[model samples]
Target: MTCGYARAVERARAGSARVPLTRASAALRRWSQRSQVTLTAVLLLVAGLLTVGIAADPDWVPPATFLLLEVVAVFLLRLRPLAVLGGTVLVCAWGLWWWGAESITPGFLAVLTLSVVAIGVFARERQRLGLRGAPGDRMLVDLRDRLAAHGRVPPLPAGWRVDSEIRSAHAEGFSGDFMVAGTRAGGTTLEIVLVDVSGKGMGAGVRSLQLSGAFGGLLGALPREEFLGAANGYLLAQAWAEGFATAIHVVVDLRTGDFTVSSAGHPPAMQLHAGSGRMELLDTVGAPALGVVADLRCAALTGRLDQGDVLLLYTDGLIEARGGDLEQGIDRLMGAADRVLAPGRGSAAAVLAGVRAGDDDDRAVVLIQRA
Candidate 1:
C-alpha cells in the first residue's frame, strides 16, 4: 500500500510539473499565430527589396532569378495567405513597371505569372478550408494517429496472432474505416470493434475520429454484448443528420479459442477452417445500421477456432462495387481471401492488398489467427 501510494504521488508530481510546460507551449503557439501577419509582411518587403537589387544589377544576377520571389511567396502563404498574395501581386507589378522591357522579359514574366497562379490556387484552397496555415492538416494527422493508437492489438500469449490494416479512399491520410480494441482479464480476453462510418475519405474523417474515441472508451468499459447498444446510444445523441455507421464487435478468448461476434447492420465476418481449407461467413445479424433506428435487437453469435483457424473481419469498402450486389461482392472477396489466406499464405494484409474491389470507399480488415 505504501509503494502504491508513493507511485501515485510521483505520478501526480510529474503531472503537475507538466502544467507549466503545457501553458508555455500554448502561449508559444498563440504568439506564433499572432505574429504571422507581421512576419508575412516583412518577408514580402524583403523579397521586394531583393528583387529590386537583383533587377537593377542584371549583370550580377540574372533578372530571371526574380521569378524565385513567387516561390518564396508560396511559402509565406502558410503564414498569411491573402496578405502574402496581395503583397506578391503589388511587388511583381511594381517590378514589371519599373524595369519593363529590360529586366522583366517575356520569359521572366511568363514564369512569374504561372507561379502567381499556383500561389493563388493554394490561397483559395486555404480560404475554402477556413485555415490560415498547415494546422488543420496537422490536426487531422494527429487525430488519425490517435485512432491508430486505439487500434493497436494488445500483446497476447503464444498461439494467437492478430493484425489489422486500413486504406482510405483516394489515398487520403485518414479514412472512415477504423478499429478500436481492448483486453480484459489479464489479456486473456481480446475485444475488437471495427466500425465503418458513413461517407468515405476525408469527408468522413471528423466523424471517424469522434466515434473512434467514443467507441474506444466503450469497448474498454462496457460488456461485450452491451457495446453496440451503447455505441448506438452515443451516436444517436450526436444527432448528426448523416452520423449513421455499421460496426462489428468481437471478443475472443485466447486460451480456449472461443469467440463471440455481433454486428450493427455491418457486413458479416468470415472464418477460414484449417481442416478443409474452406472459408465460411459468420452470417450474424443484429440491429439496423447504427444511428438509424432507436430500437436495437442485437443477438450474439458464438463460435470456436480450432488450431490454425483464422477469422477475418472487414469493412464493406473492401467488397462493395458500384451497381453490384453486396453478396456477390462478398463472394469475390472470399474467393480471393481463400487463395490468400490458404495454408502457406497466412497474411491478412496480403489479402487486403490482393483483393481489388471497393476503390471508391475506405477499406479495413482485421485477421485473428489461432496458430
Candidate 2:
C-alpha cells in the first residue's frame, strides 16, 4: 500500500512537470516563428564569419563586410527582405569575381539560400497578418483628408472679415465643434453656421463631421429662417437616441448690413456695438436642441451691423466649465473681447486664447466684423 501511494505521488509530480514542459515548448515555438527572419540573418552572418576565418587568404575581408552590411539592413535598418536579398546577391557576385570562388564556402552558399527562403516566408506571413499592406490605414487617411478639406472656412464676401478658432478637448486633429461660412445668392448674402455637437473626442467629432456636411448643404440652399428647422428635422430623422446639437446660424446682407440670427439651444452671441462700445447679447429666441423635439420652431432676431461692429459666435464650451459658474465665464469672455477688440488690435485667435475657460471641452469661436 505504501509503495502504491508513493507511485501515485510520483506520477502526479511527473504530470505537473510535463505540463510546464509543454508550455515552455509552446512559448519557444512562438518565439522562433516570430524571429525566423532575424535568425536567418544571424545565421548568414555567422556563416560568412566562419568562411572568412577558414580561408587561407590574408585579404579575405569581403565576406565579413557583406555580412556586416546585411546585419545592419536586416536587424537595425529594417529594410525589406526582398530588397536586401537583391543587394546581397549583387555583393556576393562581386565578391566571387574579385576574390575568386575559393573565398566563398559551401556553408555560406547554403545559409544564403536558406536566408532567401526564410525572407520569402516572412513576407508571406506578414501579408497574412495584415502588417505588410495598409488598406485600412489608407482608407482612414482618405477619410481624414476629405474631412480636413471640408472643415476649412468658406470664402467670405467683401466688406466682411471673418476669423475663427477651435480647440478640442482631446487635442486631436479634429474637434466636435465646426463652422461653415459661404456666400449665397450671387454673393449678396453671407450664411454662416457654427455648431457644437453633444459629447467630446472622436465620437462627437464624427457626429460633427456628418452634421457639417448636412448643414453646409442646408445653408447653401435653404432660406435663412428655414435653416435651423431643416437641420433639426434632419437630426431627428437619424433617430439618434442620446444625441443633440446646439447651433447658431447667421445670414448677413452685405449691401445693407442687415443680419438675421437664429439659435437652437445654443449660447447667445455677443455683438460689439461699434457706436456704443458696449457688448450685448443678441436676444434671439431659441428652440429645443436638434433631435430633442419633433415640432421645433426657431425664431430669428433681426439686427443691423454698422461699419466696424463685431459679432462673436461661439460654442457653449466657451461658457461651461467644470466646478465653475457659466455667468462668470460669459463675463470673462465679454471682458476679453472688450480688451482684445478695443481698437481691433487683436484677432479672434488672440481673444480665444485670452478668455479660454481652461477645461476639457471642445471650444469654437467665430468673429465676424463689418469692414
Candidate 3:
C-alpha cells in the first residue's frame, strides 16, 4: 500500500508539470499565429544585423551598423517602410559587395534561411487573414485612431450641449479638419475650437494633427483672449514651409452664459436669437490664419447667450460649395438653421447635415445652446 501511494503521488506531480507545459505551448502557438507581422519585422531586422556583422571588417565600424540600426528603427519605431527602404537597399548592396563569392558564416546563413521561412509564413498568413494594403496602412489606421481620440469632444457642463461632425475628403486615413470641446477644471467655463488646416490629403492631415495637439493643450488653459495668440505663436515657431490654418475659438461661462469668441481667418460663427427667431452672423474681425505672419493679433468678441439662444460655429468647408461662394453658403446655412433649430428640436449635426455642401473639402461644425 505504501509503494502504491508513492507511485500515485509521483504520477500526480508529473501530470501537473505537463499541464503547465501544455498551457505554455498553446500560448506560444497563439502568439505565433497572431504576431506574423511582428515576427517578420524582427526576422528581417535580425537578418540584416547578421549580414552586417559578417560582412563588415571586425576592426572597422561598418556603415552597415547604422543601416542595421535603421532597420531596427523602422521595425520598432513604426516608421514608414517606403520612406526608409532606400537605406536598407544600400546596406544590402554593401553586404553583397563585401561578401561576394565568400562563404557566409553558418549562423548568418541560418538566420537568412529563417528569414526566408518567416517571409513565406507571413505571406501565407497575411493572405489567409485577407490583410489589406501594406504595413504602412496598418500604421496609418493606428495614427487615425490616435488623432480621433485626441480630437474627441470632452464632457461639457450641465445645461449646455455641444455636437460636431467631420467628414474627410478621403475615404480612409485622417482628415484635415478637427474640433475640440471641453469644460475647464473649475467647471464654470467651457471652450470649443474648430480648425481646418490648409490643403488636403495626408500632408494636411499630419499638420492638422500637429495643430490639434497644440490647440488641445491650449484650450481652457489660457485666458480667453490669449489662447489664439498662443496658438499663433506656436504655429510661427513651427515655421511650416507653406501651410496655414484657420480656426474659431469660443469660451463660455457656464453660469452666466457670457461668452467670448475669436477667429483666425475662419468663417464667421452664427447666433440664433431665441426670441426674434433670427440668425445673426458673429463675424468678428481678427488676424490672418496661423503661420501667416509673426506676432499676429486676434480680436475676441464678447456676448451673452440668453436662455434658449443657440450658437453655431463652422469651418469654411460648410459654406464653400462648387458653384456657390461664401455669401451663398452662409445664406444656405442660416436658412437651414432657421428651419431645423427649434427649441429642443435639432442638433448641430442635424443642422450640418441639412446644409451639406457639394464640394469635397472637409467640414466641421459645432452647435452650442444654453438651457
Candidate 1: where are CA atoms >4 Å away? 1-31, 50-81, 84-88, 94-131, 134-137
Against the correct fold, how does model 2 do in TM-score? 0.63
Candidate 2: residue 38 lDDT (0-100): 80
Ranking by lDDT: 1, 2, 3
Q: Which ten contiguous residues of candidate 1 have the minimum total lDDT?
A: 12-21
The models' CA-based lDDT, in order, is 0.75, 0.69, 0.67
RMSD value for candidate 3: 18.4
Listed per model in order, the count of residue pairs whose N, CA or C atoms clash below 3 Å is 0, 0, 0
Give a tens-digit lDDT track for model 1, residues 1-371: 25643443344334222312234444544655787778677766766766666657757755555456555554445634544555565566556556563756666566666666667777777657544454444444555777677688888889988888888898888789988887999889999999999997665876887787777666655557767877787788679978899999999998899999999999999999998898999997656989988877788889999888899999998788888888888998898889888864567678887788656789998998888
Per-residue CA lDDT of candidate 3, range 281-314, in tens? Answer: 9987567998787777888888988888899998
Question: Candidate 2's residue-wise lDDT over 242-327, tens digit each?
Answer: 58998888888888889989899888888998788889888664577788987788888889899889999988777877777878
Give the candidates in order of TM-score, highest first: 1, 3, 2
Candidate 3: residue 80 lDDT (0-100): 34
Instruction: Give the residue spans of candidate 2 off by over 4 A.
Output: 1-138
Model 3 misses residue 57 by how many Å?
48
